[model samples]
Target: MRAVQVTEFGGPEVLTPVELPEPEPRDGQVLIAVDHIGVNYADTHQAENSYLAPSKLPLVPGGEVVGRTADGSRVVALLNGGGYAEKAVARQDWAFPVPDEVDDLTALSFIVQGSTAWLLLRRSAHLAEGESVVVHAAAGGVGSIAVQLAKAWGAGRVIATASSAAKRELALELGADVAVDSRAEDMTATLLEANGGKPVDIVLDMTGGSTTDGSIKALAPFGRLAFYGMASREQPKPVELRNLLGHSTTIAGMWLPHVFTLPGNVFGEAMADLFALATAGEIRAVAGGEYGLSEARAAHEALRARGTTGKLMLDPKR
Candidate 1:
């Protein structure tokens, strides 16, 4: 099987293309012929050994793939790893059938990015109708979906932040009520100004460091800030317990994998809702550049450079 492997920890340069043996499925797993593999920020962390969980050597770094099983059914599978290959194995429980109304690329989005966005707003933030929301990295995979989902759920104002003009424009096109610079020196001011000088009700933040710190200061009373990723690779300023208590604000952290552990198939339910919303044209997952299996390194480079938008994909058959 054609695949990409990371034998050493460093940067995107470490991802090397090589031929690997086919992965066999165990009793509860199914072998898939991968069509589209989802590339994510976490994949970069996995390659560099900087993810939340430590990775072993000689890793095949990808987790989401849209593929076909031996039974000829097209499905999207969330794998433990090895998705950057022509074939991969997934536990049957983690794989879901793709509706005909959904394309492979869109289905790939729902696995990691879309699911994270949904859980961030609905579960972690507990967003209410008519509330104001902020979405950082607003043109990227998760941010793009979060923007649309916030609006679809009846948010009064959706403030989007992106590093570039084009990305901000794209966020506005997607449904954000306002778009602003992600690199603003005063995030509080930028957000407040974007929201008519009012504190925001909800914030979906992945960029850490100053962004998170500033967002904490810009929250309305009882507002919720859902912290998901640290895309900036920097830690935010420490929070004061007194301030949180005084304002009655909540800062909730979300990791998609943890959502899976909750009772009642939450992960599957979110994926299904996302697919249905997408099928009905109520939500759209943006598709970014597609890379061949051998071009995995380039794909990682683009994502890390913040030069791509939406969900990055890899075509294993290429």
Candidate 2:
């Protein structure tokens, strides 16, 4: 089996390709012949050893995969690591069947970005109908899906923030009411103006640090900000207690591993719902680029530079 492993964490260059023995599935696990792998910002973190989660050296850094079993069942999976390989084992519950209409790359997106968008909006934030929402990093993997899911979940107005013109356009094409530059000097101003000169009811924040501060400022009275990944990888800026207290604002943090580790099958249920949406043509995975296993470094660089408009993928067989 061929895999990309970071023997010593440093930079994207450390994601070197190597030959490795295929992993066997454990009692409650399934071994997948990976067809497509989703390249997430977390992969960049794992490559740099900056991710908050525990990790060890000689790590294969990938968390989402789309593949088929020996029985020919196409499934998407969420793994702790080792998804950069052609064959990887994952917990049985972590694997969800991919609909016939969904391709390998799209199925890969369903596990990570898709579930994140679905769970964060539908469950964590409890986004209600007719609520005005704002999505940070709105053209990236989770954010791109979120822009659509927010509207599908009944958000009346969805404003998107991105660093590039292409991403902003992609966000709007995905159904955002407005799109603005996240790198703008006055993010709150642009976001507010886009929202018809009003604060947003729900803010989906991906990059932490300064972006989080802007999210805090952009919330409406009694609004919620669902914080997920810190794509910026900067030390998080503390949210002033007064900020939340002033408008009855709430800052909610989410980590998918934590959700999957919870008592019941919250992860499984969410994927089911997301797939149903895909089947109904409500939500989808917008593919940005596809790379071979050896091109893992390029994928990470692209993700870090925030140049992609949708999900980036790694194909071990490529």
The candidate that achieves the highest lDDT relative to the unseen native structure = 1
Q: What local lDDT score does residue 130 receive in model 1, on the 0 to 100 scale?
A: 99
Q: 1-318 in candidate 1: lDDT tens per residue?
A: 899998899899999999989999999999999999999999999998888989999899899999899999999999999999999999999999999889988999898999999999999998899999999999999999999999999999999999999999999999999999999999999999999999999999988999999999999999999998898899998888999999999999998889778989998999999998998899998889899988898999998888899999998877
Q: What is the C-alpha lDDT of each candidate?
A: 0.93, 0.86
lDDT of 2 by residue, 111-203 (tens): 888888888897778899999988998988899999999888788999999888888999999999889899877777777898898988988
Candidate 1 lDDT score relative to the true structure: 0.93
Candidate 2 global CA lDDT score = 0.86
Residue runs of model 1 more than 4 Å from their true location after superposition: none
**Model 1 poorest 10 in a row by lDDT:** 254-263
Per-residue error (Å), model 1, residue 259: 1.4
Best-fitting candidate, scored by TM-score? 1
N/CA/C clash count, model 1 = 0
